[model samples]
Target: MAPRNGYTGEGGSSVISTDLSHGSVESGESLQSTSSPHRCHHVMRPARKVAFVYAATGRRFLGCPLSGPDRCSLFMWIDEAWGPVLSRSLIQLWDQAFLDSGRAARLQTKKKEMEQAYLELWTERSNMEIENQQVVNKLKTTILDTEIKMSRRLEFHTKMCVAFISSAVTLASVLAYVLSAH
Candidate 1:
């Protein structure tokens, strides 16, 4: 005989396992049953991380995901305590190590930023130095051009002065010859 879901015969001892709402089954057809067991599936939630203070003294633990009505009442300690003093000291050391690593990471970032700024400043300084050299070259060329112009002007003035002196000397000698002949 197959298992039944509800009460069936005489003293209610005979149970039929198939659902009667889907279809009616006669007593003759009870021997030809093909029903499976009732399986209840429950979803398992993951544990949550929690920090305990006071008596736990800043320790960490994993608690059940549920609370209130459907709580699974699950709890597990992440940190094991050696003793009060030693555990607190270890926790403090771990905290300090974590803080130190964070500080080191921040310092590394700042160092990179400073290095990048320094590189930019160096590049700008190099560009400025090149610009200054170009300006100096342009100034030297301008001075050279001005000096050539000035030298040419001086040469022209000197030739004009020599011509004026030669003309005065020739005119004076001719005037003296005429006066002496008279």
Candidate 2:
């Protein structure tokens, strides 16, 4: 009979074997049975990935597409056991890849913040420059107004002096004519 999952163990617990051969004792089916009963018609039907568990680290295996309570007994090892040296190297490499990806994300966020700060500073500088230009224009207008007022005052003083001299000369002539008539 092709093992339909539920089998009793030494502790009388309902032990379900996700692997093809269940446990140590051989089952009715072969160890590497790809033509299992419950097969999904998906493109990657038999899910395959490297095992990251402590006991079977760096080993590649094919498992059932379903997980947890719905998993079937459809597991098979694709790669053989790795040597101690190779296993350690692969674990370290996986760790480094994780760390590098996190660091790269942080750096990207920092770059965006710096760009925002630069934009704000540039805007402030532009506003200050406009304000300075306005102040300079106002100062120039005030100076022109003061010069015009001074020019008008000088013209008025000159006219008053000419009129006073003409009046004095006419008075002196009238006094002479009165003396000659007498």
What's the true lDDT of residue 171 in model 1?
89
What TM-score fits each model?
Answer: 0.45, 0.54
Pairs with backbone N, CA or C atoms under 3 Å apart (clashes), candidate 1? 4-15, 4-16, 4-17, 5-16, 5-17
Kindly list the per-residue Cα lDDT of model 1 for residues 54-99, writing each as its tens digit.
Answer: 2343333344444434644444554464477755664575467557
- What local distance difference test score does each model get? 0.52, 0.56
Q: Considering summed lDDT, which 10 consecutive residues are worst modelled in model 2?
A: 24-33
Q: Could you tell me the lDDT of residue 164 within candidate 1?
A: 91
* Model 2, residue pairs in steric clash: none
Per-residue CA lDDT of model 2 for 24-140, tens digit only, reads 221222123244344544433565433443325434455655555565666666557777877676556556756787888899999999999999999999999999999999999
Prediction 2 TM-score vs. true: 0.54
After superposing candidate 1 on the true structure, give the runs of residues whose Cα lies further than 4 Å from its correct spot. Answer: 1-92, 177-182
